[model samples]
Target: MTEEPARRRYDSLRRTAQAQQTSADIARAARTLFVAKGWAATTVRDVAREAGVSVPTIYAAYGNKNGLTWALTDAADLSADLSRLLAELESAPEPPRQLAAMVAYDRRLFERAGEVIVLLREAGRTEPELAQAYREARARADDAHRQVLSTWPPGALRSSIDLQTALDIYAAICNIDVYTELISERGWSSEQVEKWWCTMVIRELLEIPTAAT
Candidate 1:
């Protein structure tokens, strides 16, 4: 009886691992199709075939293509280095260092979600759900900008630049699509993008000189 129960529990654990792997496979297939064909062109059936799973399995796992997109976004958000950035911002308590932290996070975000960000922008033009998701993503970014602005000590920002202006500058510079273009298409190195982004954002927003970065 003890052996049987142990075997059953092991089997259950194996099934759970298999299910997680299948979910990952489906998500990967869906992202590939969405990137290759755009949202409207890609269907759940295509994802299923690409994943080597049945259509019903795709439906059961993700419900539809939009669901898969959401999963991808969620994965991107999770994979980003936000927590470390936030911790750095909190601990540094200086504008230049905080800007570095933000740029570091932005670089990680590009590495993880650059294509997905571009895909959403393109698909949002046609898909209402993706449009809403894109809007929400911008809102989240705005909130992060506000957090970064608030973390700086007094006299950190340039006298000419107010909090709102600084926030706007943050939004403009931290754009994933722009960073992706600079790195992937324009062939700029990650170090180049990071240095330029830090320099520009610091020059525009901080009272400190850009050379500090």
Candidate 2:
């Protein structure tokens, strides 16, 4: 009985590892296809072919193409992953520094998944499922931003700025369109963008001069 239980544990661990690897492979393949072909044109068959898994596996792991899109979104979800950083933001002594750190953290996330996010925004225009997913993703980030904002002691924010405006500024500057504008189209380097992001987030949102300028 002891031997059988040990064997079962090993089998379970192996299956878990294999499942994680399979999901990673699928996500990687889907990301490539999405970037190359755009979300609207990329189909499950293409992903299955790219990932070398069956369509059923894709569906099983992530219900459909839109489901796959959300899986991608979840993988890149900034709110889901910030532990130490979030705590750091909460503990920061001033609002400007906290906002700067938050922007820097979110900048790294956008750097990783900005292309897919842009694709989803384009797809969202015509596809209802993707549109909903996109909105929910934004909501989650907004909620996180709000939580961080709430950590500020009273009067840390400018008297003129309200909760909603602060959240809006955070969302707009950190979103894909601005990223695409500065980093994608205008040819700003990642360093330039991150610097600008931190500065602008501090100035416009927190109403403070960035330390550099």
Candidate 3:
């Protein structure tokens, strides 16, 4: 083959690889757009155009817009990280320490959940499946918190208080929506929020008397 023809063939191969890479990139971009703009507003053509590829490329790689969405959702693990944080709190040393740890853990968890929350909030408007998934994930988190509170030190205030009540209290303070509203909407500093959360948890759940400095 002539050198010119050989170079043309190599360039064609390079273009094919670049197109495949663009498909994956488009899938990710589509996820963000879908979450930010909603599924009804976003289009496969928009995703392909954003990723600098042809619409046919996206169809070839993802098969369809729904396939791309499913791929993105399956790839992300928003629930798993929250569960891991709760597990860490359960393994913590003592009630006081666990309460403090849980506060910090939840802060971190919310940071990760921020994107997922946006997706869920937008998805809930039109997608029943997505809404159901969000609810199931939230229930799992609540159950995890309840399990952690069950390990609270004995003789805590309102020892008569039911586990559900304790869980509710913790959930109220540590909830991702509550945290975002306080930290982002209300402009509370993270340190202040964490300190207050830990104090509340310590006093209510652990029943620790605060020492005067």
Candidate 4:
């Protein structure tokens, strides 16, 4: 009887592992297709073929193209970097250090997920549902920005800059579009982009002026 129970448990574990592997393979295939064919042109069938799975598997796992894009975005997220940088920002004693931590996190994020970032941006432009979702996500980011800035020491921000304006400036300059333009289109290195991003954010949002100015 014990042997039978052990066999059942092993089978269950194997099935679970296989399912996880299938999901990962599907996600990888979807990402490759999305990048190569662009979001609008890539289909579930294409991904299924690439992953050696069926169309039903893709639908069951990810629902639709939008779902796959979301999954890809989640997979590409560098949560470890975010946590480390958030901790670094919190412990930072001064505004410059805090800003550096924030910028560093953004740099890491864009560098690792530049293609996904571009994919999402393009998808949002053409897909109404995703465009709404993207707007909502940006709204959440605004809230997060407010919370982070609230912890900063007095006089860290420019006297003329309000919370809303500060968030807008950050969004405009540190966003994926600008990153794509600089890094992908203009052939700028990741290091160059990070340095330029840091300079722009410091000059636009903070009281301290960048050396370039």
Candidates sorted on lDDT, descending: 1, 2, 4, 3
| Estimated TM-score for each candidate | 0.69, 0.69, 0.59, 0.65
The residue ranges of model 3 lying beyond 4 angstroms of the native Cα positions read: 1-33, 40-87, 209-213
Screening candidate 1 with a backbone cut-off below 3 angstroms (N, C-alpha, C), the clashing residue pairs are none
- Candidate 3 lDDT over 1-213, as tens digits, reads 354543442343244334434455664566567666777788888888776888897788778876565434322333224344434443443566656766776666556546665576567678865676566656755654555566455665456567788777788777767777888899997777778888876677655544211
Which residue pairs of candidate 4 clash?
Answer: none
RMSD of each: 10.6, 9.4, 14.8, 11.1
What lDDT score belongs to each candidate, Candidate 1 first? 0.71, 0.70, 0.61, 0.67
Whole-model lDDT, candidate 2? 0.70
Off by over 4 Å in 4: 1-30, 36-69, 208-213
Candidate 2's residue-wise lDDT over 69-98, tens digit each? 765564454322354354455345467777
**Global Cα lDDT for candidate 3:** 0.61
Model 2 residue 36 lDDT score: 85
Clashing pairs in 2: none
Model 2: CA > 4 A from native: 1-26, 38-61, 78-94, 207-213
Supply the global lDDT for candidate 4: 0.67
- Candidate 1 structure quality by residue, lDDT tens digits, 1-213: 354443442343244334445477676777777777878788888888998999998778868766676645554554564446645655565678778877877888778777887777777888888877778877766776676676466888899888888888877887886787898799998879988888888888878665543
